[model samples]
Target: MINSIIKLAFGIEYDGTHYCGWQRQREANSVQEELERAIAKVANHVIDVVCAGRTDAGVHAIGQVIHFETKSERKDISWIRGVNSYLPADIVVRWVKVMPNAFHARFSAVSRSYRYIIYNHPYHRPAIFSSGMTYYDDFLDIDKMQRSAKCLLGENDFTSFRSSQCQSKSPKRYMMDLTVTRHGLYVIIDIQANSFVHRMVRNIVGSLIEVGCGHQPENWIGNILLRKDRQLAAGTAYAQGLYLMLVRYPLHYEVPQSSIEDFFLIPLLS
Candidate 1:
């Protein structure tokens, strides 16, 4: 008897510029559509994919995780190449592996980390039509931005920083960590949370930019949280600069990559 279910984890990357996002929509291009189509051709059957999180249009992911089940037995690792052959160059499956039957990619996630990159030089704006990153040429005070970001570290009603279009019933979220770092002209903002609401990260970045620009007092973030008003927040940061970096799960669900050691050549002479 052919096995009924084969659990697999897939690492995927995509240039979301032309797509409407990761989810399906009417006449809208999406990463999910491309992936499902590729899988159907290879497995010769319809398959449903479950992802750790949804990425908005123009966003990017260096380590996005997803899982799916198929009734057919996978023959070998060449499945990656076979799938890639049909998928667009912008969308590629890095690899796939059999996971425990009980492992779930979405619900089992413990945390998610996102990295936002911005170019802060007047002449260093992101490339034209570059939909995967944002460019802000004005000078920003990184130290002030970091200080303002600290007000978001604890659990709070993020209504102020969320999009008005958000459909989530509640706006409360616990921010695990938020850091702003500067490297030459690039300002990197890293955020970790148990979960995030729609537009939360972008809005937070927008608010921080306002503080960094001295348009708002340093205590602005705290005031917004206390105010709990969406109108109090600044415009959403450009979607292109955000990336879903990593998804964390319980220790038992930890993924192991044997070849990672080989990828980093340790000195044999040492």
Candidate 2:
């Protein structure tokens, strides 16, 4: 008798506050390391997972996706509950599904979405969920931020917004949508792209904040993009403010979509 290998995909969520990052590291704890260990315990063999996006340290993910191959057989419910039993509270396997071997967690993804939450009050700090959002004491001009964000829509070479350490072969990316909205004291920056270079979203947010704070004009964002100079852009924003919101795959794959309401307090955008 021969055992057949099976492929499974998982929807994962993690606080990402304590772990170093998603990838396994030699010296520190990582989200991938913890997850693999937990799944290994349940599978009775070593397991490796490939995530749709490898989020940096301190960045949270509510819609993370991953896939792995295994020879063991188990029901979807058993995979979820059994894996969670050995994992830390911060990391969780929210859903599981058996997938065709052709499906890939990262390569099959069509688009990735990210949300950055900012507390824009001057005096008081957010006592609740402080670790999940970034606080800026200075008042931000939401109108200015929104105007600057418009230039980011469509495909462009995002060299100005990419990190020096980025390993991507090209600086080009398709910006499907970019929006800045305000809900009470909270300001939200939502972005969707075909793919991103390292720290691209945070870097763009940093430059936009400069515009919102009056340090730079709204036109500055467009100028920065045209210049293609990293030094002309503002510093990268805090990782805590960032959240991996969604990953979309082709309809044939039947990958589940995640809801923003699961991790946010703001009203859903129309």
Compared with the true structure, the alpha-carbon lDDT of candidate 1 equals 0.81
lDDT of each: 0.81, 0.92
- Candidate 2 lDDT, 86-146, residue by residue in tens: 9999999999988998999999999999999999899987898898999998899989999
In model 2, residue pairs whose N, Cα or C atoms come closer than 3 Å (at least 3 residues apart or on different chains), thus clashing, are: none
- TM-score per prediction, in order, is 0.91, 0.97
Query: How does residue 12 of candidate 2 score in lDDT?
Result: 92
Q: Scored by Cα lDDT, where does model 2 land?
A: 0.92
TM-score: which candidate is best? 2
- Per-residue lDDT tens digits of candidate 1, residues 27-128? 999899899899878888997898888889988876678898887776547678878899998988876878898898888888788888777787756565
